[model samples]
Target: MMLENSKYLFDRAQKFIPGGVNSPARAFKSVGGTPVFFDKAKGSILTDVDGKDYIDYVGSWGPMILGHAYEPVIKAVQETAAHSTSFGAPTEIEVEMAELVKRMVPGVDKIRMVNSGTEACMSAIRVARGYTGRDKIIKFEGNYHGHGDSFLIKAGSGALTLGSPSSPGVTKGTAKDTLVADYNDLHSVKELLNTHKDEVAAIIVEPVAGNMGCIPPAPGFLNGLRDLCDAHDTVLIFDEVMTGFRVAKGGAQERYGVTTDLVTYGKIIGAGLPVGAFGGKKAVMDVVSPVGPVYQAGTLSGNPLAMAAGFALLSELQDKPVHYDQLEEKTTYLFNGLKKVFDKWDVPVHINRVGSMISVFFTDEEVVNYQTANTTDKELFRDFFHEMLQRGIYLPPSPFESWFLANSLTQDMIDKTVAAADKSIEAALESSKVDSK
Candidate 1:
């Protein structure tokens, strides 16, 4: 597709905005091309500035589950905006949102809203530390828990894509308390708990890791972590910013049947609005703000506009619980179709999927953790990505990121996407053969 206007916009944006994008993932640095500037999106389609329409698979990085400009969400936002935007005070909508969330999600006794997932995660850790009176926390490798200073160490997604999991700005002192463990590996977590003993306050993890591709927790992985936390007197936190309400209504905790002490949410909770929330058992959550010693506050925590949009989106999901099943069916269809295409093209690829979240890694090995996920042939993926883009299918810019499927995608779109994959795989295979020679 010709992106002249997008290129122009990017050039102009770079004069003011660093890397011509606010978010690093939007820069298309890993994909080796100019990022397409989208003018508008509706349903499962994104129309770029140059008037090229592509089937969107990124879903705004997991928020647009119902799809872009979904009627209910848009209507709610419009209706709420006419009243006011931010009041800096509590509203009935906030209370309603909390009640609705608690009704749908399991194990959440109280929830605090925030502007973004990063803030939710950062505050959750602070609350955990305050509640437990311990300073250290263990985080799994390859699980991107937002870009908080503590989470930057061995982070995934943007950090891994930029080849800097440990960012420069984060101080050494901040990194010390953050312990890193391998995902899908129970032994590593047990080892960390044994070494840290009473010093560890919490164990944070992405129950269904979306960063470093879509890796699901191993057979007993989540339960094992829960057990370890129980034995160590540590708070177990599920950073479900990506998996929450996407994989399942209540998220990984609900799907896996393993309860967590704290859970952080983003994306779907705000219905694509800038919002996030962290909630847990009343005892742990009580430590935040007026009730307890932990200091955490957001001026725009539960902005009326955001609450309305989120409530609308959540209500739809609540009313139509079948949407989850429909999403799974579509995702399975796409995954199976892609697998068939790769097989036909004789391209060695590993596809990881969990519900509506999926990833295509150009490798034969199973991608269980960061180490294995890194073994993918990025060059082949870049070729595949461009080929798919050219065929009007928009994939995640980086192999480290998950492709979020929206309910808006029809069977026709999935079939077209499969056809695109067939051609893309052929081209990628040809390119790999040429490179080998």
Candidate 2:
């Protein structure tokens, strides 16, 4: 648990990188510590610079579904790299990747690749606006669709963790067009649609919310959105960046039996590489540049390395669809084990899980949405996080983020995690009591 090396690296990183981390979540600011600098990771274990090993659950923020350095994906990247990297033009692998996506995903007739989830979402919003000829887009509170200017208002994930749901750089004009709604509350969406009427372009949501800690959509919540969008002629967008490929073969849309007008993907789609995509019905996607006039382009959009890696990972997932079931079973085992530990320790906690995405909120209240998710005692979670880290279990630094379990995690790892939780919960509770005294 000694983070001396990590501390040194953090200090060095701070001299160059903002907050000593490229991503705010990596700073461990909310959890109160210097972030661990990993030397390498393989399977479910992350080896830090100091050579300490911990069972990993963050999974590089949801991309390492098959686990870090998965052989097939790595091999694909290596082979593709031997040929070349970015062409800035077109490659056959890109077409193969797109075709594979269309085959696996439910409603993706056509797709456009992007460098990141943020780009995918931002581009999707533009397509929505161009197709509908409307300005406003409705996004649920705590449903982070990346750092796009339009998506910053009431955003979650890093924004929520950093206590700035709306960043300052986002102009008022952009904010005005992005309406925020309460997740799991259909009435809030109805109110926005009623007020905005035909002016709204799209309604975007994380089908199974991962940013606000894996809050599954309430019963009929997604279907409700679908119905409302159908009635209002507004595009329905599912920001499946975290859940795609990991939750199921086709993602939340397949798992829930709900089709969306557009779907944005990241994480598992790239198989730990930096890649993203937005796809939907042919008609809606046809509006994007060269086809109709929504201009969105990326120099490295379909970099050969990314396409090969993504295709390799996805092909495996497609071939062995049972991996999804295995992942869910493992997650359920871990969840139940953790629950038993909390119960045994008399620790008040609420757990929310869907497929392999899960969260442990240090509160008794059910975490159905961002507001309820925020009710969890941050101090308690901070204590729990450190305690678990000390015991060789690495959880997401912030409670607002979901813990993505990888297929690489074995029963032994789950058992160890549960055992760690047992001790960590007691230690955390003891620390809270000591602080109160």
Clash counts for the predictions, in order:
0, 0
By summed lDDT, which 10 consecutive residues of candidate 2 come out lowest?
266-275
Report clash pairs, candidate 2: none
lDDT of 1 by residue, 89-110 (tens): 9899999999999998899999
User: Which parts of model 1 are misplaced by more than 4 Å?
Assistant: none
RMSD of 2: 0.8
> Per-residue CA lDDT of candidate 2, range 1-437, in tens?
68999999899999998899898878798999889899999999999999999999999999899899999998999998988888899999999999999999999999999989999999999999999999999999999999989999999999999898889999999989999999999999999999999999999999999987889999999999999999999999999999888789999999999999999987567787888999999999999998988999899999898899999999999999989989989999999999899899888889999999999998889999989999999999999999999999999999899999999999999999999998998899999999999
TM-score of each: 0.99, 0.99
How far in Å is the alpha carbon of 250 misplaced in model 1?
0.8
Candidate 1 local distance difference test against the native: 0.93
lDDT of each: 0.93, 0.93
Q: Candidate 2, which segments miss by more than 4 Å at Cα?
A: none
